[model samples]
Target chain A: MYYRSQYPRDLFAELDRLQREMQEAFDFSPSIRGLARGSFPAINVGGTPSSVDIYAFAPGLDPASIDVQLEKGTLTVAGERKAAEVPEKSTVHINERFGGAFRRVITLPDDVDSESIDAKYRDGLLHIAIQRKQEAQPRRIAIK
Target chain B: MNMNESTQVAKAAEAARNEAAMLPPVDVIEDTGGITLYADLPGVPKDKLSLQVEAGTLTIEGEVALDVPQGMEATHAEVSLPRYRRVFTLSKELDTQKVNAEFNQGLLKLRIPKAEHAKPRRIEVKLT
Candidate 1:
């Protein structure tokens, strides 16, 4: 899904490729990261002893319009944000908000239990939690 | 059900205190009636969001709340900050008193109507 087309592409797409290359060369910290022109929605994935948490930040979307699916330890979040209406004779100044179909795929760690997953959308963020299997959980051992 | 509300609130507060502010994406449109501004602020609830206008300046701020489980460690993370802040200069011709705003699904829309004098007026022709 991250692959680019071989044929002609838009100027924005070429710029995105350049941005990706810069990111690779100088892995900037997310705390002060710059805009990623290619990716529609930003996501964060983390895990604990019990479960793993995934968050997708995509605003201006209806909860029902989103589709969350997990198969073979790969989680995919897909959704679309309808474009805002621009009245006739109106002048647009800045348009940085994303408006289109977006999809993000992430592979979970081996400890995660694929079946035990819960996903919810609220406050323009999608949160997904997946439990880890019993054997995969960390346990303290007694030194006797 | 597993985590308590108070603990989550405390965690959110701590996160907000430690994190740095990031600029949120926005769209601005102008029409005859008013100017409409759309800001994307995911993970920020209504209660945590604030809009302020002072001395011809508008400020948008919100603290994002991240719900981390009891003792979860982050194996991977893209963004850990929970604060978003942006300031804009308000035009003198805009009617700040009548500014209207609406928030839905972490998106904020603000409309600043044109001042009465700033609006276009049609004058009647005098017949002698």
Candidate 2:
């Protein structure tokens, strides 16, 4: 006879909680939608069998001030962008630059190698390289 | 051609030149320590972005265009538009090594770290 057991209800509840948190964390909606006052950061995620690549478009922000964290298959990016310097005696008619505190989070399914992750910034773009988990790569075995 | 006709031609050429000179707007702010600059440059790629600092001013230039392909007509474009160009003056306390910048979405973030001498520090106290 074969014995089978189902997952505990607490474990299922925990999984549900995590899913809710993930949904809240990765919301891509802007605070002021359809308004020209702010520019929402664009993001791209690409992956191969052995690696995953994430790109964030953020300019004029101090790299040191920005923070990136990954936990429980979730990626969180947060930072504060200072306002651009303006001359004392200049009057401006139109202002369309975005400045303030901003935060973005994403949930990833791929097993990312946090230790091997690499981040690079150039021309105002942040590129993150995440090595895929070894088990996530497909393989074949010969039968004896 | 008459002198008036030649003058009109020159005026027309000058107007064309002005129309073609469409540079993005920029703002530079100077504080007691350093300067901060903000530039509006949409659709600028990392390879095309360049910054040059000569004399006392820093110049940032990037080329961006709405690529509608060879035979395609522009129906609508609301994502990104044109290019951005801006410049700024650098101060002495602005540490170039610590100067950090990032660009997300379409916003450019630049931080000119203050010099060691300019940054605030706290003295530790020892009790006997």
Candidate 3:
């Protein structure tokens, strides 16, 4: 079974590499722009019968700087991560964190109630909850 | 490849990928006082963070906890829930004893002070 899985895994990796090479060949700019696509803050969206929840993984952000906007059924979270101040006359060894303006958009289900949306930031994570419309919720039918 | 060999190879590849993925991005700044390191570890609470210095090496580990409501199904997920880990070698010129760390909103800030000998000194001229 393990041997069988390896073949497909290798094939997938080969295809992925080829796709990346083709992208590079067609585009002169770097594939990952600062805080773009793969580099943007990641998010998770889940829903229950009552409400929809969104968890955004954004560390090193000032909660006050974060901006949340809802339009139609789309929710956008925008913020800027400021760069740390490096003292003068000091040599920098490594820097991997990307800092700049970032905007993440999530489309909520049509059943969500925009007026009942709430968001909070804590411990470097942003939580957004939107209540589901009462009519859209699942209901149990009664037998006569 | 045999089943056993293939399993071993797959395990090795998985381990390598996890190591790469868990490496949290960091920014190291050096000043006259010492060097400061900043690491971005999202979703890690203060209590779940660990920092230690042993044998001139500094290690930072943060566990990210995701709270999912019960009976809820995830429809879309782009973020991964992986613990953050990173290590740095401290030079002898740094005063490890005076090292201090502060965490706020998922950012870890470490301040390592410079030893007396590492600081710049001025020599006073004596009248002949």
The top-ranked prediction according to TM-score is: 1
State residue A139's C-alpha deviation in candidate 1, in Å.
3.2
DockQ of 3: 0.41
Give model 1's share of reference contacts. 0.75
Per-residue CA lDDT of candidate 3, range A62-87, in tens? 78899999998899999888777866
RMSD of each: 9.7, 17.9, 9.0
Q: Which is superior by lDDT, 1 or 2?
A: 1
Ranking by DockQ: 3, 1, 2
**Rank by TM-score, descending?**
1, 3, 2
Top lDDT model: 1
Structural RMSD, model 1: 9.7
lDDT of 1 by residue, A15-79 (tens): 67667656764796532233332376777777777888998888888888899999887888998
Identify the CAPRI category of the predicted complex in candidate 3.
acceptable
Residue B2, model 2: lDDT of 100
Q: Interface RMSD in Å per candidate, to 1 decimal?
A: 6.9, 15.8, 6.1
Off by over 4 Å in 3: A1-37, B1-21, B121-128
Candidate 3 chain B worst ten-residue window by lDDT: B16-25
Q: What lDDT tens digits, residue by residue, belong to model 2 across residues B18-50?
A: 332224444545444444555655446766666
lDDT of 2: 0.55
Chain B TM-scores of the candidates = 0.77, 0.55, 0.74
**Chain A TM-scores in order:** 0.72, 0.66, 0.71
C-alpha positional error of residue B121 in candidate 1 after TM-score superposition, expressed in Å = 3.4
